[model samples]
Target: MTEFLDALVAHAFLQKALIAGLLASIGCGLIGPFVVVKRIAFMAGGIAHAVLGGMGAALYFGFDPLAGALVAALVSAILMGMVHLVWQAQEDTLISALWAVGMAIGILFIAKTPGYQADLMSLLFGNILLVPDRALVWMIALDLVLALTIAACYRPFLALAFDAEFARLRGLPVTVFYLLLLCLVALTVVLLIQVVGLILVIALLTLPAATAGHYVRSLGTMILIATLLGAFFTTLGLALSFGPDLPAGPTMILLAAAAYILSASLSHGLKQRRARLQIRDG
Candidate 1:
């Protein structure tokens, strides 16, 4: 560990990865709790996958892939939100269809591209160490946007998450808020792709929040706990990956999954024990 810390301080790529992990953790911790509470985890996954269509088009057209991904993600998110508004019962089916179609479009475009795509695997599986300095700039900007937006509209989001109908009845512009939340999710997917890739982003987003849910009562507290857990997972995972030369994204996610399982099991066991003690006292 000491040697690894020494190397981390000595290396610039490692420094970037560390900063990237911390920023991504903070962003995911904040957004992920709302995602789980709102039951939009699947929709978030759909957007993550669908962004590939934009990436492929950008790759083929000699444009910025992240720009393409953001556009694609926003469009898909809006479409999904509209579908949910119009046909709530059929939204899942539509999301699944969109997910498949998006992936197909991306594959077709990539296949048609003439040159070899060296960064393709990194896009799919993620390589935090490969994150460019420019991309870090974008990530920091997006994190600021997300943080400010959440802070400004926290109450409306809380109402919407806990009870949309109530929020609507209270004249909170439910549709607008809901769509806005989805848009944020799109941005989050883009941001998190750096840390965990499109394929594993959802896990990083949810697991920390979910594990925090086991211990925290309020949404704010949950986000704080989740953020700390995310940082812990990311830092440890990156350090562990350094020795084995393994992919950091998957390593972080696997560690998060392990943490979630342990936290959940422990929470359940404690609850059961408390119930038994309560019965004995009675």
Candidate 2:
């Protein structure tokens, strides 16, 4: 651990990885709980996978892949949101179709691209150490945007998450807010792609939030706690990965999964113990 900390000061890639990881944590922390609470994890997954179509198109046409991914993600988010809202029965089926279609489009485009094709593993599984300085700047800018948006619309989002019909009754534009939330989800998926890639992005987004949810009652509190937990997990996972020469994405996710299991088990034990005590007293 001490060696890793010292290496961070000496290594540029390590520093960049650390910065990118933390920035991604901030975005994931803010958006993750909303995803879990609103039960939109599947929708978010669809959008994340759907970004691949844009990626493939970009590769085929010699354009920026991230830009392509961002556009694709937003389009997918909007499509999924509309499908979910307008035709509730067909929502799952449509999202599944979009998920498959996006991957198919990406594969087709990539196959058509000329020359030595770049390795797709990094885009699929992620290599945070390869994050460029420009990408870090983009992540920071995204963090700012997310922070402002959440601050401005926290209450309405909270209401929508808990009870959309009631929020609508209270004059909130439920459909608009719902769509806006999906857009944010799209942005978050894009932000996290550089760190965890499209394949495992949802796990990185959800695990910390799920762990934090065990202890926190309020949504805001869960976000704050999840953010911290995410940073810790990523930093620790990065350090551990350095020793074993492991993939950061899977390593970080494993650490987070461990934490979630620990938190859930501990919480369940405490609840059971308290129940037993109460019963004995009675």
Clashing pairs in 2: none
Q: Candidate 2 lDDT, tens digit per residue, 172-241?
A: 9999999999999999999999998999999988999999998888999999999999899888889999
Please give the RMSD to the true structure for each candidate, in Å: 1.1, 1.2
**Candidate 1 per-residue lDDT over residues 1-282, each given as its tens digit:** 776699898999999999999989888988999998998999999999998899999889989888999899999999989988998899889999998898888878888887736667888889999888988998998889899999999999999999999899999999999999999999989999988889999999899999999988799998899899989999999999998789999999999999999999999999999999999998
Clashes of 2: 0
Clashes (backbone N, CA, C under 3 Å), per candidate, total 0, 0
lDDT of 1 at 222: 87
**Which ranges of candidate 2 are over 4 A from the true structure?**
none
Cα TM-score of candidate 1: 0.97
Model 2, CA-based lDDT: 0.91
CA shift at 25, candidate 1, in angstroms? 0.8
> Candidate 2 versus the native: TM-score?
0.97
